[model samples]
Target: MLFDTHTHLDAPQFDEDRDETIARALEAGVSRMINIGFNRETIPTTMKLAETYDFIYAAVGWHPVDAITMEEGDLEWIASLCSHEKVVAIGEIGLDYHWDTSPKEVQHRVLRSQIGLARELHMPIVIHNRDAHEDIVKILKEEKAHEVGGVMHSFSGSWETAKLCLDMGFHISFGGPITFKNAKQPKEVLAKVPLDRLLIETDSPYLTPHPFRGKRNESAYVKLVAETAAEIRGMSFDELVQITTKNALERFGIS
Candidate 1:
C-alpha cells in the first residue's frame, strides 16, 4: 500500500475527471490520500472529496497566498470543521515568497494565527513553504509548532532547512520535483532525510513526476515519488511505501 500525504485533489484541474483520476490512483496502489484544501473556498470541496472517497481524507486551511482575503468567520468555521471524523489536519498553510500574493506581513500574521488554531485543535498541519524558508522556520519555532507535528508538503529545501523542520517534528515529504533533473535541492534533501521522517506525494495536477511531467498529475503517480525516494535512500520500493505510509498515518491520525 502507498499513501499520498499531500494532494490537491479538490483543485479545479480535476473537475473533468476526478473520479477517474481517483480510480487510477487506487489501481496504482495509493491506498490513502489527504485532499488538501488551500483556502476558505477550497474547504467544501476538500470535505466533499473525503466524504465521497472512503480512502481520501481531508486537510483544511488557508494557504499563504490566499490568507489575505479570508473573511473573519472563515478560520473559526474551518476550525469547527476539524470536528468532522473525516477531517485529519489543519494545513496547506505556510509562507510562500515565490509569489507576491499578499504583503509579507499579512501572510505572516495569518500563518501565525493558523498555527495557533492548529495547535489549539491538536491536529497536525500540512505545511507549504516556498522561497521563505527562513521565515517559515522562524514562525514554526516561535509558535512552538513541535507540539503539533505535520508534514512539510512538497518539501524543497536544503538539508539544513530540512533539519530544522525535522527537529521540530515535521515529516519531510518529497513530491514530483524530486524527480526533476534540475531539482538539486530537493534531491539533496531526499538523500539525507531519515527514513522514518520521510513521506511522499504527487501534489496532483501540479508537480507531476518525470514520466508524467507537464501532464496533469494524480495520486496514482505517488509511487513515482516512492520509487524516487527508494533510490535516494538506497532502499526498495516496498520498504519505502511501508515506512512512509506508517509515517503518514501517524501524523494524520489515520488507521
Candidate 2:
C-alpha cells in the first residue's frame, strides 16, 4: 500500500468529482492519504473528509501565505480539533519566502506558535518549506521541535539540509516534483536520504507527476511518485512503497 503523505483534496478543484477521485486512489493502491487543512475554510472540510472516509486523515494548521489572516482563536480552534480521532498532525505549516504573502516576521511568529502548539499537543507536524530553508531550520532548532518530530513535506533541498532535518528527527517526504524530468536537485536529494526516513506524497490538485504534468493531480498519481523514487534509489517499486508507507504511518502515529 502507498501512503500519500500530503494532499489538498479539499481544494475546489476536486469538487466536481471528489468521490471518483478518491475511488481512483483506492483503485490505484493508495490506501492512505493526509489531506491538509491550511486555512480557516479548509479545516472543517478536512475534518469532514477524514470522518467520511476511513482511509483519509487530516493535518490542520495555517499556511504561511495566510499568516496575516490568522487570529488567536484559530490556534485554539486547531488545538481543540487535535483531539479528534481523525486528525493526525499539526501542519502544512512553515515559511514560504517565494510568495512573501505574509511578512517574514509574521510568518516566523505563526510558525513558532504552531510548533509550540504541536509540542503541547504531542502531535507530529507537516512542514512546508519554500525558499526559506535557513530561517525555517533555525526556528525549528530554536523551538526544539525534535520533541515531536514530523515530515518535511515536498522536500526540495540539498542533501546537507536533509541531513540537518534528519538529525533533528524529521522525515524527508517527496512529492510529484521528484518525477519531473528536469528535477535534478530532488533526484539527488532522493538518493541521499536513507530509506527508513523517506516518504512520498502527491500534493494533489497540484505538482502533477511527469506524463501528466499539466493536468489536475490526485492521490492515485502518488504511485508514479513512488515509481520515480524507487528508480532513483535503485530499489524495487514494491519495496519503495512498503518502506515509505511504513515511514508515513510511523511519522503520523497511525496504527
Candidate 3:
C-alpha cells in the first residue's frame, strides 16, 4: 500500500475526471492521500472529496501566494474545519516568495496565524515553502512548531534546511520533482533523510514525474515517485512504500 502524503486532486485540472484519477491512484497501489485546500475556493471542494472517499483525507489552510486575500475570521474558518473527523491536518501553509502576488509581511503573518492555530488545536501542519527557506524555518522555530510537528510538503531545500526542519520535529516530504533527471539536491536530501522522517506525494495536476514530465500530475503517478525514492535510498520498492506509508500514517495521525 502507498500513501500520497500530499496532493491537490481537487484542482480544476482534474475536474473532468477526478473520480477516474482517484481510481487510477488506487489501482497504482495508492491506499491513502491527503487533499489540500489552501484557499477559500478549494477548501469546500477538498472537504467534499474527503467525505466522499474513505481512503482520502483533507488538510485545510491558506496558501502563501494568496496570503493577501485572507480576511478576518479566515483563521477561525480553518480552525472550525479542523473539528471535522476527516480533517487530518492544518496546512499547505507557508511562505512563497517566488510568486510576488502576496507581500512578504502578509505571507508571514498568515503563515504564523495558521501555525498558531495548528499548535492550538494540537494538529500537525503541512508546509509549502518556496524561495523563503530562512524565513520559513525562522517562523516555524519562533512559533514553537515543534510542539506539533508536521510535513514540509514537496520540500526543495538543501540538507542544512532539511536538518533544521528535522530538528524542529518535521517530516520531510518529496514529490514528482525528485524523479527528474537533474534534481540533484532533492536526491541528495532524500538519500540522507532518515527513513522514519521520509514521506512522498504527487502535488498532483502539477510536478508530473519523469516519463510523464511536462504533463499534468496525478496521485496515480506517485508510484513513479516511490520508485525513484526507493532507488535513491538503495532499498527495495516494496520496502520504501511500506516505510513511507507508515511514516505518513503516523505523521498525519490518520488512524
Predicted structure 2: lDDT = 0.94
Model 1: residue 197 alpha-carbon error in angstroms: 0.6
Q: Report how far off residue 149 is in candidate 3 (Å).
A: 0.9
Error of 2 at 114 (Å): 0.4
User: Candidate 3, TM-score vs. the true structure?
Assistant: 0.99
Residue 89 in model 3: shift from native, Å? 0.7
| Steric clash pairs (candidate 1) | none
Between candidates 1 and 2, which one is better according to TM-score? 2
lDDT by residue for model 3 over 22-91, one digit each (tens)?
9999999999999999999999999999999999999999999989999999999999999999999998
RMSD of each: 0.9, 0.7, 0.6
Candidate 3, lDDT over the whole model:
0.94
> What TM-score would you give candidate 1 relative to the actual structure?
0.98
Q: What is the lDDT of residue 250 in candidate 1?
A: 85
Error of 2 at 132 (Å): 0.2
> Candidate 2 — which pairs collide?
none
Residue range 1-255, candidate 2, lDDT tens digits: 999999999899999999999999999999999999999999989999999999999999999999989997999999999999989999989999999689999999999999999999999999999999899899999999999999999998888899999999999999899888899999999999988999999999999998899999999999999999999999999999999999988889899
Residue range with the least summed lDDT across 10 consecutive positions in model 2: 173-182
